[model samples]
Target: MTTFTLEPQDNGRLQSLCGAFDEHLKLIEKEFNLNISRNNFTFTIKSNEENPKSHHEKLIQCAIKLIQDLYMETAPIKGKAKELELQNVHMALQERRMLSQVEPERAKSDVYSSVIKTKRGVIKPRGVNQVQYLHNILTHDISFGIGPAGTGKTFLAVAAAVEALERQEIRRVLLTRPAVEAGEKLGFLPGDLGQKIEPYLRPLYDALFEMLGFERVQKLMERNVIEIAPLAYMRGRTLNDSFIILDESQNTTVEQM
Candidate 1:
């Protein structure tokens, strides 16, 4: 068992960090499969003793750090604990741990200080994986980012695409994703083919919107400089001088790929 107490002991901040009914702590516990007992500002985290230096231990440590970081922020956490938020925390923990374990030579090679320039400002890699991902996209004919959700795989890809487009390295940007619904039928949804697939492609749209702004994105779409479509529509089409991004690629079938 590893135990520690947050400093100053502010009840309201502690409550905000833990959430209603300690839901946030429960989420961390469930994710790491550990027991977390809390008394005031003190927390005790316990896990199996077989592996003293397990990933779970690291997760707990990272979770504690995240909690402290959030508590110190000016804004307080509100509402119910969200799964996406927890997943992002977990992803950050994984990235931090991965970077710590990277060999010195590999770290030197993988580290990137270059930032991707966009209309929104500059986009930089948050971790070694992102640095390598961007490097691969810039160097290779085709690059893929495979990871769980909230890992910024799709977001970074879109950023790289946007940067490439801004630099005239690619004349156009093509964004596509498999039209797979999560326990939802496509026919049941309203609108035409494009409308039906809009939800699936919304993430890509959001990234583009953030990078290039709404008006510019709309104009680009009108001119076909930025094209968004379903993966099914990509058949029999040859792409050249285009930055293509396929999001939610795990849902894609073998034929779609």
Candidate 2:
């Protein structure tokens, strides 16, 4: 790593800016793995060996801003300052980068590697009675989890899809719905069919997000790995090894069905 010198102006300004606490310099040094030495006015920073200077500079700026805006006068150099200082710096840098591109692959990889297996209450496992019905549908390649709205019909259906995905039983999950508003045609609604139906599809996503997390859902969407679309989009395609959830069955015509 190379050494860089900060002139009195930069050093004095930074020290004055972060002078509220003694540990602030240590926090920055550890986070970016740099060596910081200062004597009242002049400061020198040895660059981090692992991360490039660009990342280090951005991190430094982040620490300075956090110290200026957030540091409390009464609180000693507790760990909270370090935590907040690091979080602010990372968040600012993340916002400026193409965060999705960097993060999604890691998310997908992590989900695949995760071993903490247990049930979360967001979606219940289908009961024996419901499982039997789902089994018949899976065997026949067509079935419906039909009932009134409050029941676990849609949620269970999505859960089955997720289960299938986790088991490598399916290559994808496809969620679609009929878009028939009482007053407006699908065309008159703002965007294309997918856009028009997104609001309606949100409940499906909510269920998925609860079972999975925000990051997994976003990564899946980015890869075209999971889809929630208007029923019309399902036309002229043969789907294989995938879970298909078609909501609002009442709205579809026999031909569409």
Candidate 3:
């Protein structure tokens, strides 16, 4: 069991952080498989004791830190503590922790200070690795970002693609992913090729939607300025004047690449 208290907790900010009826806490608990109980500003997080240095413990700590950060910013709590926000919190915490373990000089460097412009606003890299990743994307013809889940790999890639398209740097944007199922058989799914494959490509669409807005993304798709498809669809085609993003490339076979 881990216990901590939030400092200078205003009732309104606390309410916003936890959401109405403690929905935010419940969401975090569900995701981390932990029990969270609150008594005013004090919070108790309990998890399986058999495993020391557990991921659940880390997640709980990150959640608490995120709550404190938001409280300090006086950010609106309503609709703020969603799955996406939690995911970002997890990523930020993971990056910060990892960077802290590395060389202090590298951790302090402002390499990722460049901002990526989008229709929504400027997208900045949250950490040193992300900064290097964006710099590579900008300078190199081909770049790869390989990392475990909860990192901003896909999100940053989509942001770069959107930025390029918006600046007229690329005539079109191509997003592709392998239509491979995890354990379930794809043959069991109903619908045509496009519909059946759409589920696999949803993450790309989601990132694009966040940066470009849904209506604008749809309009661009209609005009073929933005193209998304299964990797298999690109077999005989010659792509030109395009900023292409291949997500979930690990799921693709050798021939697909």
- Taken over the whole model, the C-alpha lDDT of each candidate is 0.74, 0.58, 0.74
Highest TM-score scorer:
1
Give candidate 1 misplaced runs (Cα > 4 Å): 1-100
What are the per-residue Cα lDDT tens digits for candidate 3 across 44-107? 8888456756576776775666555544443333324222244444554555566567676765
List per-candidate RMSD values in Å. Answer: 10.1, 17.8, 10.1
Greater TM-score among 2 and 3 belongs to 3
Candidate 3 residue-wise lDDT at 28 = 63
Total clashes for model 1? 0
Off by over 4 Å in 2: 1-140, 182-189
Clashes of each: 0, 0, 0
TM agreement with the true structure for every prediction:
0.60, 0.48, 0.59
After best superposition, candidate 3 residue 215: deviation in angstroms?
Answer: 1.1
| Clashing residue pairs in candidate 3 (N, C-alpha, C atoms within 3 angstroms) | none
Candidate 1, residue 31: CA error in Å?
29
Please write out the lDDT profile of model 1 over residues 1-257, one tens digit for every residue: 77888876666667666766777678667756778898888888887456666667766776676566544431322332222244444554555556667785775463543457665654667778787888888789888788877888988899989998988998999999777865568998799878899887888999989888899999999999999998888899989899888887878888877
Model 1: lDDT to the true structure: 0.74
